[model samples]
Target chain A: MQAGTQKSVLIIDDEEDFAHTLAERLSLRNLAVQVACSGAEGLAFMEQNLPDALLLDMRMPAMSGIEVLRTVRQKYGMLPVLIITGHCSQEDHDRAQELGVQGYHSKPLDFKELFEQLVEVLHQK
Target chain B: MTDKHFMAKNLASSTHELQNILAIIKESSCLVEDVLQINGKPRMKHGDKLYHSLEVIGEQVDRAKVLLRALNSFAHAVSDGAQTCDLVETGKQTAQLVERFVRLKEHALQVVVENGSAHIACPPEEVIEALHSLIIQAITACTPKAPVLLRLGAQQNGQALAIIEVAGAAWNPEEMEQLAAKAGGSVVLAPGVCTVQFPCAASL
Candidate 1:
């Protein structure tokens, strides 16, 4: 897909394998995908090159997904961000909604649902 | 109550009690088999504690099985006759059922599973179920950003037992004690962090 036609997605997750696999899958669908191993790294990358949407993992070593989401919201208001988490509790879901997360998905991920949500968010934006 | 009614109720209660006793015997037998088969050196210092915990958990499973059997027997007594059942497998199956819950939580979280494959004599299901409760408790106690290091391995001593150690930020003594009590496990505050240990014995 051409650069202008394809949407850019930034995946921020601690799980290297899961992140890579996801990036590969999304890339196959003709989306430009960039990955960061941690929340801090993700923030730095976002500063340099803003993606169309960010897919963030909730749990991590240093800064959490929620922390990253908070930072992203502060720096770039109205940025479309998706919170991806392994454990999806009610509290997490509620918090993600409160923090203006554009989407949320629990692992083991439902790729179809995630893709649809990502497309919906990008279209709206 | 009428004589017939009283007799029926008494029979039901006795049947239930008998089932529970039989379950305990079967679980104990499996544990004995595990103790015999386990080979090599253990890792943790508290071998006895791990063994005792596994035994106790097995015993509890047996008790639950017996109770369930009694309920089943009461129904049979009221309608059909007493039936022969495989209590050993029942005990094992029950353990397995509990383990499923534990396995799901363990995989979803960032905890590491260290150690040799320590199978419980009781059913894999039961161990997982009990472990699930313990895992959830640990997850709730952890700080969001802090790393929760989970170690599952044998004690340093030569024993047919497995230990699950969840290490994280220092937890409230009261809260840890409450969680431990609920999960039938012990919680200790280690030097650098809080640790909860869940012991499982080999399953025959």
Candidate 2:
């Protein structure tokens, strides 16, 4: 993907507001962003669409971020995945890193940093 | 099993939800700011005011995050029966959670740590509750806008003392004694001050 070119990004989190606002922000930055409110919905979307990058939340109602990441790593090993969390522990960080996350971030995020990371991952992918 | 545990569980869940809510507000406000910057706001009326409003929203979200963090810590205070706790950190956390309470009563609450880290052995939830109750009572009884000072100090013989001083409020010796006993500490009273002393877990 090149700068100023269209890129697809998928965000998986149960937080509707965060997902939508993040999508809007990414769209403003010229990326086509889609959101899934649950891990099941996220996996469903991935079957039909191949996003350039992924933003995943660790805590969800069904199929946790780790589970989603595991499935993604198994099916789409080369995809760039970034972990987002609110109540992250050391165990979560180590686990995500072990499973090959591109980056890790905590909630109340710095959007500029996220945008930079997103672009960097898209470029790498 | 206990009510405190139940309340802690509820608070933990609720604060997690609240964090999600704050994340949304944060991103929405950021989106507004992004739009303004991308469009250059040259032709839009009230663009400056709108940007300022978004800034205010972002600031309030930050403030809410702090309160939620303090509340979450308070919620987890009941997770253990009795443990070694940092007196300074715990007092600061308690003060942050009830800062609003003091403000709403038109009184001021200030937390001061005169000594370095002091470790105490106690049920953290009970200590927090006792501090909250005493502060609220003092704030309510004191003259409007008077300051209530919460000071933490380390003592000899491996003890830590927390002093609650209300400038214009009278002391309640009997109630203070009960509160101190319930919190696993002893109380000392001055004209408008109540002090609770706890044994340090490490020293014990």
Candidate 3:
């Protein structure tokens, strides 16, 4: 995974507009981005594509972002995940950190910070 | 305890409660103001687009001011310790407060009031504010152009509740359920729509 390369990113968030908007932003930044509107869908998409990075939303319906993170780690060990959430409770932050999330951002997202973090993550990967 | 000690303790408790209520009102008002200011800012740097965005933002801020006033009054009423208030009216007012967000996103909001006029004994402001947050969450959960159907009515058990239903093409039941759980409620998804019910008692 490298900057300016066609690296893929998977976004799992229930907020459709926010997810699409973020995907569009990521695409503009030269990353191939695919969005899943739920954790389940994100997991399914990951199984198919195995993206370079995953931008996960912590709060989602049937499957939570944490649950998705655990599943991804179990399947694809050491995959980079950036946890994004609207309500960033202490519990969620602690859990995400404990689970070894590569990056964490709170909503409403600051695109500049997110882009910088994404670049760093991609470089490391 | 002696009368003097009892009176002093009562005064101290009342003062503490009032301070807490004021803090809540202040915090909520600050959030409302921030939302207005953020949404009111120009979306672009270009002259004409900036101007148009500012104008739209001004209108939204004005609308938000009205809502803030209503919220302020409601807060006052609750702080005043009003024993009997109209819960249904409070619910409607709360819905209106968050209606701006729905309209801003260009979502069609269909509010169905099944119960004409039912009164419940509770702090109207708290219930209204909670409901407003719930509606805002519901609106945010949907697609920009999707219709958000809100049903405000009394439950079969005579407990007032507000039901927000959204039928987006990509409505995720599990995501909604998680959101509901976070909001201290639950969500049920049907064939066409997903509904989140916030009971009045729970709000209290």
Candidate 4:
């Protein structure tokens, strides 16, 4: 990331501890970060605040990542969304690809790589 | 397409949950390292030890991830009744799936495949089970701490083959014959050496 450019990132995941811990790590890198423990909360947060990039977990209670992606695209067109998942089925993968998310990454991620990707995505805008 | 085993569903579900848990453990470790790297005093006494401990945690998490992935692959092996799989890769998966069992016996497994992969059209679960049975038999017959080696290759005529060799394993031709009959492949058993053929191998 460029000096003096603070990228804001929102992570929408059902895993509470994981979401927050990741948020904390990212925040330490000079980025404004927030975590929503569910798709609904993430949407509510989005209604008030929009981050530069969003990381959405694939499987969630009540609403899946694809469903959230659909709603996000409809409500806020062209928001850069990245898909994060533990294990994704082919059908969900195909759907996520169709939705035009910026990237799809698996869990147990390499933190440095993910940060690099976040930087790249932020730079694109 | 039918679920071959009632246990597979639970195994698959459990592995997914474990993967997520492992991911959190890793991220938390990374967070610790991040803090240390950024703000730790230059002369902190325990800094190096803490960094080494965090590295160990990261390595173990990576190791667990590999095992979990192998378990997940094993659980889903029975998804398609007629699915074709590469013999060499399947051999490696079988080795990974039996990690705990080998550890309990104070043993290890090594898979060897020369050059390109070999494909077999047999049912995936059956192939896995057959290779597993051979490995278990070899482990039991071998001396302590001996590595159970699975050699995957092809015959001169292009048929795929698998051989299990554990030094000092008791020779048992009868059991190998029966397994061979079921798989429509030939078997040759000798002391610490067993070779099984897969007649339905698509290619090498």
Which 10-residue window of candidate 4 chain B scores lowest in summed lDDT? B74-83
lDDT of 3 at B164: 67
Candidate 4: give the clashing pairs. Answer: none
Candidate 3 off by > 4 Å: A1-4, B1-204
Per-residue error (Å), model 4, residue B71:
1.9
Q: For model 2, how big is the CA root-mean-square deviation?
A: 4.8
Pick the lDDT winner.
2
Q: Which fraction of the native contacts appears in each prediction?
A: 0.00, 0.77, 0.00, 0.77
- Fnat computed for model 4: 0.77
The C-alpha local distance difference test score for the whole of candidate 4 amounts to 0.81
> What 10-residue stretch in candidate 2 chain A is worst by lDDT?
A84-93
Local error of candidate 1 at residue A104 (angstroms):
1.7
Which segments of model 2 are wrong by more than 4 Å? A1-12, A23-56, A65-83, A88-106, A110-125, B79-84, B113-119, B140-144, B152-156, B191-193
Error of 1 at B172 (Å): 41
**What is the alpha-carbon lDDT of model 2 when measured against the actual structure?**
0.82
TM-score of chain B of 2: 0.88
lDDT of 4 by residue, B1-204 (tens): 334566777777788799899999999999988887787535678878878899999999989888887777667655423467677777777788776788788988887886367777666666777777777777876788888888886554656788888888875677767766665556788778888887546543
- Which has the higher TM-score value, candidate number 2 or candidate number 4? 4
Ranking of all candidate structures by their lDDT, best first: 2, 4, 3, 1
Worst ten in a row by lDDT for model 4 chain A: A82-91
If ranked by DockQ, best first, what sequence of candidates would result?
A: 4, 2, 3, 1
Candidate 1 Cα misplacement greater than 4 A, ranges: A1-4, B1-204
